[model samples]
Target: MWDYSDTVKEHFFNPKNARAMDDADAIGDVGSIQCGDALRLTLKVNAESEVIEDAAFQTFGCGSAIASSSVLTEMIKGKTLDEALKVTNQDIASELDGLPPEKMHCSVMGREALQAAVANYRGEVWKDDHEEGALICKCFAVDAVMIEDTVRANNLRTVEDVTNYTKAGGGCSACHEGIEEILTRVLAETGEAFNARASRQKLHASKEKPPVPGKGMSNLERIKRIERVIEMVRPQLQRDRGDVTLVDVDGDTVFINLVGACSGCQMASLTISGIQQQMMEDLGEFVRVVPVPANHAATTGVTA
Candidate 1:
């Protein structure tokens, strides 16, 4: 279980500024179907010119969402249009004292909803330059640059999926909501543009890695690489019923697979003891045999 800070617990239980404005001049709403977090922001802006008169929010998710929304409402109240636009997820996180790495996205989302709502109020549009060739999240179809900017700006989601896919955390596990922020921004900009973004990510994933020049090595030279091939190939061998995952490495080690009938076959122990043991022994002391399994484990009977 994660340790909830006192501030987090307090805000979770008693989130401030938790309501919807009856006479809101502008409104913004964001939701994530996968993570199950949603927020609605309302603003009362000064007419004649775009200035914020008041702000409020309603959120549905964890304590982080509630606290973020509550704090965001307090932060933007009485601020002018320009000043309120500057309010970011990081500011909300700071106002709450601080949030956990994962919950940072909640604060960040509140800020975006505010921005979207404010933009809706005015006739202005945020036309990003890299909208065409942006790298969306590989997982969630979030734009890369937008996610990066959102993470830096809001200090939200740190998980890799969130960062790359949604602008929460794409590169690593700590920032996910950042990915969601990017998704939200993109969806707001072009609600039906998800298809293009997803296709781009797929294209990137299917591309083969180009061979590096001058880095090529022969099979014999490469087999001598590293200390443990046994552990690496265990699962691969298991897939072929202990047939062959790793082939004979120059009569030293024989590569075998453990799959089909041999994966969970009752004769697995017999195969290991008879054929595997005899092959390794016949190969001599310096000779090593590598067996690759299908699922996880692999075995290499060698040290050097």
Candidate 2:
């Protein structure tokens, strides 16, 4: 069973503003019941001051979802619409002490609802269909823009991190590749390295063994695990304004391309040796880390 925080349980058992406001000045609706989560937020704004006088929510989801929506209403109660727009999903999670990573998507839902509500009040066109970006996760109706924004907002690294925060790859695993592509682009753009250990510590804290490697592992699984290991060593490389990108993995051989300062550094061999040692330790297998030329075209796999 998932552990529920005390504040989360309190709101779940007795949620505030759980009713519909007949005199609401604006209403924001998001999510789909077909996707197993939906939320409707109502607000009563003072026309002259543009401050939210009242707020309420009616949500169809798990306890965390209800609590998130319930708490969001309270958070926005006396704040102006502009002020309330600044509230992020992280703030909602922080307000409730903390939520299980799996339930973090509930907080994201609440943040979207708030945005929708504010947009409605301002006569803007905002809908859950997410027409701005291509739909990446058909099961959850998550779009590329949503995934990219969440990744930037939370500094997400792995597909698992995106799944936890946005529910993009949580359903059918088909969108995993799309999510990874987005992560790579966003992290590269910001020059931010993925912290694989920190993002996944909670989930693996109790596991004694790392996943078995190189047995019947599929190509995608190998790439994912390889990328994780690269992310683990990326910070060290990034410290010197250098980075490594996973180009391809053929059997036990991993192809990588060094970029920036490490591209032609004298210590590139030592860095590759360190990465090889780390990969062997983490993957529980002997592997070769080969550096490709800077302009090498990768046939398959993802950059870390």
Candidate 3:
């Protein structure tokens, strides 16, 4: 039972474009059952005009997810691809008068589905800029480009803010630190939005927490947590015909090496980002994981 806004409840109960469009020019579908939400979007485009004549969606998700998709379709109708591309998760949430922090990810799914459809319309390639960056959130397949874009687009200031706008850290929470780093870096780019050094200081200044047993995670406990996160995300890589092996853990940095098919795959940056994010969520916010760098894991799409 959540206190959903009137718009959210209205769209959830009577979603627009709820039916399928068999003649859609492009269809973008993303998310998974494991993540608890998925969207299938279809659009009928007027190619000569380069405009979306009609759009429809069939979503399998919570109330927010459905509502997000519903509102998304309405927003994009009669707009050119350029105009549609500008629509983001923030726009969807704003339309619904905002969502609870934890449920923000649902809106993100709507945006992804629309992006995928737009990409499909343009071509089979996933032209979304984020796919080229590190994939930070595996549960929802969130990438660094996506998170950075959301932060910049909405001026997200904190990890929780990132989650609110893009749901980057809402799922497993392993990517909380990774998202925080991105938030800091994005803010630093503006030269006034944030202080990266101060942010890092905050993450490392946890020494005040007593080292007493049961008071906080011990070194051994932390190592075990890291291992569990690896195991949890390992299957996701395997599905891509790739493999990852732990190489070393240096302070906050966990270095891993990619192998097999993924060793040379162009999508490795995304893979590395996914691994780092999951570890941060499982191990807590101070983690800074990196791949062994294929050279140095190809510099990871998300830079320091």
Candidate 4:
């Protein structure tokens, strides 16, 4: 189980200002129910002082999402829109003591909602959608611009880290190479070392290997070993209201489908990494875990 802070639990079980405000002066909406997370923030502003007199939110998501939204409403109350705008995602996580690295995206969502609400009040155009050319992750509607901004804001170091923060590269696995390119450029500009290939090699090296390496197993033997490793990891995910199913295996890449809560989870990247590490150790060979769409069979073929 995740080690949630006491304050996070408190706010989740007893969220404040969770009701809709019919007379709100400003409103912001983000995410979609189809995506397994959505939030609508409403604010009552004092016209003369430009202060947020009240705030409320309605969200459809996990406990962390509820806590983030609840704390955001309280934090922005009595502050001017400009003052509220300065509140970052880090601040929200701090206010709740702290959120797990996997749950940090909840805080980011809260910050975006506040920005959208302010834009609404100002009568300015605010959109989260991107053009097809700029889109990066079609599964989550995450664009390259969003990925770049998040990498800078969070100092993200890996494709997994980006998935935890922005849900990019968390599904299909086809956008991973694209995400790595963005990360490489961003990290270079910031004077950070981000050798994508080296980083991946390092991750593989960090995993424990078999005591004695065998010559190599046949394809049938390899598939069975992968299945056994996945079976070992499946119970842990199921305990958390999620599950995984093997879709197909092609050479070093093992395709799988995340079902239940795991389907759109922000922690998916970590989950995939864990599965990959285990498979490599058990099979005594390099392997990559790639999450495919649940309906992968309907598609032409899994890529990446």
Give stretches of model 3 more than 4 Å off: 127-304
Off by over 4 Å in 2: 127-304
Ranking by TM-score: 2, 4, 3, 1
Between which residue pairs do clashes occur in model 3?
28-117, 135-270, 173-281, 174-280, 174-281, 293-296, 293-297, 294-297
Best-first order by lDDT: 4, 2, 3, 1
- Candidate 2 lDDT over residue span 1-304, tens digit each: 7688999999999999999889899999988898788999999999999899999999999999999999999999999999999898878988898787567778989999999999999999876654336778865557898898898898777887787566676666798878878987899898876555554684465244443456776777767888999998788777656899888777678889988767765557767876886687666767889999756665544334
Better of 2 and 3 by lDDT: 2
Give the Å error, residue 59, model 2: 0.8
- Per-residue lDDT for 68 in model 4? 98
Local distance difference test, per candidate? 0.57, 0.82, 0.75, 0.84
Error of 4 at 9 (Å): 0.3
Model 3 C-alpha lDDT per residue in residues 272-295, reported as the tens digit of each score: 666765666566555666667434
In order of listing, the candidates' clash counts read: 77, 0, 8, 0
Q: Flag clash pairs in model 2.
A: none
**Could you tell me how far off, in angstroms, the CA of residue 188 lies in candidate 3 after the best superposition?**
25
Q: Estimate each model's TM-score.
A: 0.42, 0.47, 0.46, 0.47
Residue 267 alpha-carbon offset, candidate 1, angstroms: 53
> Candidate 1 overall Cα lDDT vs. reference?
0.57
